[model samples]
Target: MNNLLQINSTDVTVFVFAGIIVLALLFGFIMYFLFSYRHKQKDFQLLHDQKQQIDVQKIELEKTLRELKSTQAQLIQQEKMANLGELTAGVAHEIQNPLNFVNNFSEVSNELIEELKTERQKTESERSAGTENDIINDIEQNLQKINYHGKRAESIVKGMLQHSRANAGVKEPTDINKLADEYLRLSFHGLRAKDKSFNADFKTDFDESIGKINVIPQDIGRVLLNLFNNAFYTVNEKRKSASDSYLPTVLVQTKKLNSAIEIIVRDNGDGIPKKIIEKIFQPFFTTKPTGQGTGLGLSLSYDIIKAHSGEIKVESKEGEGTTFIIQLPIL
Candidate 1:
């Protein structure tokens, strides 16, 4: 009986210990599952926040691109307006010359007509035949004057019309020297008309041997006008500070090289500074203060000559003067 009771007790203790260990293991598994679920939820929240940040960044970038494109369009429109303004201003200046001639001539003709009528009445009433002859002479002289002024006006109008015409394709066998001379005179005259005292002594030494070349006359004329205007401005600026004894001079010379024609424009004004020489040809670069210059003149002139398979160069020294040398191929 005693042996049976001890064996039953040992079996009971072993089963009880086994049951307690299984319960502990079950509890540990439940706690582990809860902790893992919490960690996964936190990870999902972080990923959602990151995605929102990325979306926000994309929206900002898209806005910036739209703004940039809008700004670019505005700038292009502004440039077009500026160009139109320049063209209108130049056209107005061109029309003023003939209008002035017309006004002056019309006034003179009206005065002459009234004077002739008065003289004829006097001749008829007093039987003064000599007065009638004088009246005829006066009418003839006035008529000639009118014709002269009319022709002058016509020539100016024609020149302007020719200049304003749409450029035909480049023509060959063009006399470059003559074209240069024409532009030189026109530029000088235009400047003189604007300011009567702006006249300076101009000397030309065109190479008679510079044979005809392929060029567009109107385009080249615009280039020459730009260059000549610069030269004129330089001389005029210098003359302002010059003593009464100083005489302003501008020299324009041309020569024919082996395969090209070179033209030189020299002025006795203050030369370009060393520091800014390299930038002079750059677009929108100018030494003139403020409104005195548009700064596009040289840049445009440079481009035009380069398009014609030519080169332009400048040389200068401080306190001395500046010279621009342009070379074009003789085709």
Candidate 2:
């Protein structure tokens, strides 16, 4: 009977040990589940917060984009105004010549009229026949001068109107040689009017063989004016720091081809640097100081030429000079 009791005690001890191990495993599982739940909750909250932050940031980005667009519009308008101002300056310079001739000839004609009136009052013997004829001839010439200049001024005004008025983008037969010459003088005189100290010598070599081609005269004129302005600006800038012997000069030449024409503009100023030469045609790329340039001249010229199925390129050597070549197809 004692041995049977000892066996029962040993079985109870084994049962108790097994029960304790099962309880420990249940506690371990509970702890693991609790910790995992907490971590998952924290991760979910973090993601929710990040999503809210991203939404707020997106709103701010949209606002910023709108503001940027508004600023861009303003700048574009400013650029347009600047272009109009330059063109006006050019027009004024061009018109002044004819106006001056008109005034001077008017004054001379008035003097001749006064002389003829005085001669008429003199005695028949005192009034020489030759004197009347000479005065009449001189007055006729003066009248012709006035008529010519008045017509020139009228033509210039008409041209200004044509440019200002809105029209369909139609190509017309344009004499590029004459167009180039006109703009060169216009650009030079406009610059001179703006800056009294500005002075430069210019040379032109126009190929008379290249007759009128179908083009938008106003557009091509604009391109030529821009190039001429840039050339003059470069030469003028160089003149400031250049030696006394340095002479600022701009050269414009035209060459005719069977299927194309080349307009070459060269300036004896500090040439463009090699590193930035390739980017010259890029919009908003400029080497000029702030407020000095809009950086749209070359970029616009490039686009205009490309629109007309033409090409424009630049060549430069630092501290020497720069040249721009424009090739336009004979379409």
Candidate 3:
């Protein structure tokens, strides 16, 4: 009985040891699986983070590309303007010589016509009185028309020369009144030349006390011309849809201050909308049709005013009128 008990005890011990080995193997397998799963999860998270960073970088690149394109376009526009300025100066100079000749000869021809008329009148006879008088009158009328148009052409050429001059970059003592009046008439006549029936009630009130001011006349002239042109164009557009009783009027006035000069250009025309008023001075912003305007007028004028240590502002009411106020230092 003792031998049997010892043998049974030994068998039980062996069974317990085998069971322990099985459990150890099972636990090892579970740990290996958990570690492998964790490694895969970490890799997937890292990939996700890298993708997000790439997306952000792509967005930034796109923004940078857009800004670069805008800058490039502005540079191109500036280059084009410079080239156009050179071309305009060349054309104006070429036209100026012939224009002077035309004006000079026209004046001389007018004097000769008057002298011929006088001689014909003194030698008048009943034999050919009616025919001779009619010929002389026709000649005189033709010469008068020629002289008038020649003067107009000369004025236009002079304006072109002034506009193309490089003197706009320099400041000199200038007659403000004379400059304003000269440009006002030039702008009006330029419009008239384009549209024969275009007319406006123009008024001016210049302060004589303003006297001479040190300024870049060419630049200021350009600014004034731009303002006048806009005023005329606005009123002309309004006239198209307005009643016959509606008379378009543009008024220009100047005032002398202690240390500054003020110019006000007002027009009875369709005024600017509030939403777009702020954008008027921005480069390439314009209300005019695509081909009718380059949109640089106000922008250039604004820069010019700044360069002169001056200020420009606008006041407008829809359907009533618009006014542009420019203030320049007396210096």
Best by TM-score: 2
Worst 10 residues of 1 by lDDT: 79-88
Model 1: pairs clashing at backbone N, Cα or C within 3 Å = none
Q: Top model by lDDT, which number? A: 2
Model 2 ranges off by over 4 Å:
1-80, 87-90, 122-130, 163-169
Query: Cα miss at 231, model 1 (Å)?
Result: 0.5
- What lDDT is reached at residue 97 by model 2? 86
Tens digit per residue, CA lDDT, model 1, 150-208: 67556555645545554333656777777777667666766776676785778899989
lDDT against true structure, model 1: 0.73
Q: How far is candidate 1 from the true structure (C-alpha RMSD, Å)?
A: 11.1
Error of 3 at 222 (Å): 0.7
For each candidate in turn, the TM-score is 0.56, 0.73, 0.58
Model 2 scores worst on lDDT over the 10 consecutive residues at 160-169
For model 2, what is the error of residue 186's alpha carbon versus the real structure, in angstroms, after optimal superposition?
1.4
What would the per-residue lDDT of candidate 2 be over residues 1-331, giving only the tens digit for each residue? 6656445777889999999999999999998999998899899999999999999999999999999878765654555456556767777978888999999999999999999999999998898889988999999999999999999889777765655444424799899999899888878887888889998999999999999888888777768888998999999999999999999999999999879999999999999998999898987888989987888778878987998999998999899999999999998
| Candidate 3 local lDDT, residue 240 | 86
RMSD of each: 11.1, 9.0, 12.5
